[model samples]
Target: MSDEEKTPEAPLAAEAKTDQVPSSPDSPVIASATTESERESLPDLPATESFSGSEPESEEADGAAILDETMSVRRLPRGLIAQILAPEDETPVWIDPKRLGRQSRRDFLLFGAATAVSAAGVWWLLPDGTKQQWLSPAAASRIDSIEARFGVTGQRRERFLGRVLTFDDDVAEALYSRNRRVRAYRPSDVTPLRNNYNGRTPTGGYLVSWKLTLSGLATGKETTLTAGDLSRFPVRDQVTRLCCVEGWSAVAFWSGIRFAELLRAYPPAPAARWAAIESAVNLDGAGQPDPYYVSIDLDTALHPQTLLATKQDNRPLSLAHGAPLRLVVPMKLGLKNIKAVTSIRYTADEPPDYWNERGYSKYDGL
Candidate 1:
């Protein structure tokens, strides 16, 4: 204990000479010689030291004060650190990269606000107007209520109810179909009159009368026709042929009354059988209603010359020919003759005739 105090203090003589050295079985001995100078300046130290034990510097300062009291205490368990930072029933949990970039910018602003509300609801439901086929304000309010109740003006002639009708060439191809400029009034130019007569014939005294009326008769009932019911209905002269399925032909002189005497003064109901009629002018503007509408069969509305005219040749009937009332059926064709008779439906089916629903040929009678 005297040769320099038994040769010790060189850092306690290198910590008691590495605590009496004896570490080998493939070495890993660090018991602190200042942790072997921090494991030899950390060149990843390890070439051998096999640890055993000894005061190894108070067991390396009580194992570095129990690893600094287990790294300052509070180890895990707040539900295991919220289940190891949350997901592990076999891995997924990543998200929080700032909530996945705020949920992909709130799903790209809700897919650009649902594609701008589906392109503004398809430009507010389309359809505007310019006439490629326009007319739906209830078919332009039924052609402005039949040209404000049957337009009338002036023009004079005088013939009323003469008879003997017949026009041919398939009634001039159903009233001018392939439109060869209205096939020039075929059926040999014209000459077929008398149908239903309600007369007053005195030629030059200018009194050609012949009236018959029935405003709107779709069963909603409303009927009127006087002048003593058109002279108590008898003068029905016969000579028919106004055959005009557009092809055109006009003998002219259809008198009045007889739509089987105004459908027997408003009868229709033995399950009727169809007889649409209705006209006033729009013919094809797509806005429907005009000297157009044709559907028949109630055996041609009780046929005995099916009329409702109001005079044609001697006078009275004028608004371009279908005055006040017009519908003469001498076996049809001439679009079932409807012209300003407002309404008259008695259907047990088969109605929709305007040019047979536009494609033509619905018997269109002879």
Candidate 2:
């Protein structure tokens, strides 16, 4: 029984092996079963003609035409587009990334430079910032301490400033500075004192009896001149500015006689180096000869611009303006132009003046 079953199975296996045998190369089955490598080695099939019957113009032209027709443009997506559309009011039309980088860098540099310059300017203009250049904080503190301890008498500060002013004045005088002209204005431009006035009104009722005394002339004699006597001299007018140490200033038309004319009439002695003029009014109630006199250098007294004013703005002098007479010297500060004239004396020595003792500069030029 085992031999018969085995014989049947062997025959069936033999038939299966025969049926699996390869077909001939000439058969359709063998051609259909060809591998991709074998098919690739064979010649390619002819392409179908695109145009009906026309031949191409040239091989180069046909190749170019083919490339042109087949070329595909790859465009960026809508979301990837750069600056294009914009509102009309917008300043920048388009912002190029590369250009913006360069401009922003330049603008940053300019802004930084401007900020630095502004900071330096502010530092230079402020007193606290510039104080180091004038004096150290420690030195200034020491000066303040000395003033406080000395009870505000200004002795130390006055001495210090006096030395400073001496040096300053010496330099200024030696430099041959040109005299600054006072501004001129029409007589109508006289700004009335309205409300602002300086110093006190004249007391002792001397405005009525005030007379100008001229002494120590070339003749070594004394001469007293009244308002009528001064008016007899040649009358002149000058428009000059009166600048006060307190920082108020005004321009006025002053009608008067030039001191040069007066000096010519009553010449000064050759030995005289100074001219002292006294006022009839007392500034200090104590009457310590206070502001009673002001002395000018001989050169200043002889300056062409100096005046012995009898009138102001073409009108007779008012009581508040030293009624009878006032010395109007334009080249000097208003303080030096003694108001209420009582006496004029020439001396070889520097005459004592009211403010000079008060620690003010004698050469108070404009």
Candidate 3:
């Protein structure tokens, strides 16, 4: 296939524990955290760096007294709470007191009130003397007042808040190596999901007739390709894990042309900073108005491990696994590894993806 042959490559929560039992007589009970900006400013320690979790000799004597005073919880330094809650390996080297914002009495009171309200709701929902009502009238009334004040319906608020919350250390680590390979797996290790297909499944005959389309390249050119044309490029096979948001993962040997190679073969316009991948399946029947698609930054689209995957485990891709051609982006979450890809478009604007539109982050890396 040539530039003249237009083909679409179908492509592409945490809880706070307030256990304050001191470990040792000399150990401080409260440890603080730096602000997000301050943390950002510090250089990341080498993986070999280690801290014994011991205070400096100069501060050791005073640390215990400070610990006793802050152990009350009410007077606990806000930054200290975060350090106390974090696992030892993930904890910061040192907490900067200056980063702890001064919360006024009113702010403290409001937090206390919110905690009380939450406790009340939990208490009301528990069975008491066989009166297992889901919620007590008083609790429900208070909740309703809060909801009304926020002008948010219960379902909408829950879904929105759910997506916005995170406490996973792995997630934080993933950001640093968003474009680097993180895990590997053997062919047998690849998970075969019972219902991996996210949306519409392509027809059994689709692959035979499928054409890959490329448009909006830096060369001000367009191209269409057949499966054979893709094979003509250098092929790479990588053992990379696919981490899904649903909490399952599999390592599979994905074989295909590096996406970088594809881009080099069909350069996009210099102004293009984003690439959109569209699939053949359209479960919603929304048609052109709402075709299922996902977009990624050009840097990601060109990651060496990113592939126009055509095979899995040295065999042709199964239909359920985005047969024919699917995207393989090791650094990104599963949603961006679009299946049964049909077209690729380059643009200056960041194109939206199916999940991103709903609530997921645009950079669903790692």
RMSD of each: 33.0, 31.9, 20.7
Against the reference, the lDDT scores of all candidates come to 0.50, 0.63, 0.64
For model 1, residues 1-366, the per-residue Cα lDDT tens digits are: 565566544454344335433342212333333534433322221212222334543335322433231121122234545636743233233334654565456558878998976654332223323211465766644544443354311111001110111133346435532112112233344575433212222122112343333433556565655446655766554446667655656566557777777677677776767777665332343433344667776665676667777776545566545556667775557766765455566777876776655545665665
lDDT of 3 at 272: 91
Which portions of model 3 show Cα errors greater than 4 Å? 1-142, 145-174, 188-195, 198-200, 284-290
lDDT of 2 by residue, 1-366 (tens): 665486655554333223322222222342444343222212211111111222433333223323233122222223322212322222223345655565457558979999976754443333442445567877655644554564633354456667877787566456423354446667777765421334566554776676788998999889988877887898888887777767877787788888878888889888998898887565554434455678787777667678888888788877677667788877777788777788899999988887777767766766
Q: After superposition, how far is residue 256 of candidate 3 from its true place, in Å?
A: 0.6
TM-score of each: 0.22, 0.54, 0.57
Regions more than 4 Å wrong, model 1: 1-261, 278-292, 295-315, 323-337, 340-346, 355-366
Off by over 4 Å in 2: 1-157, 172-181, 194-199, 283-291
For model 3, how does the per-residue alpha-carbon lDDT over 98-144 read when each residue is reduced to its tens digit?
43333234347778999987865554443332222555766656765
Worst 10 residues of 1 by lDDT: 155-164
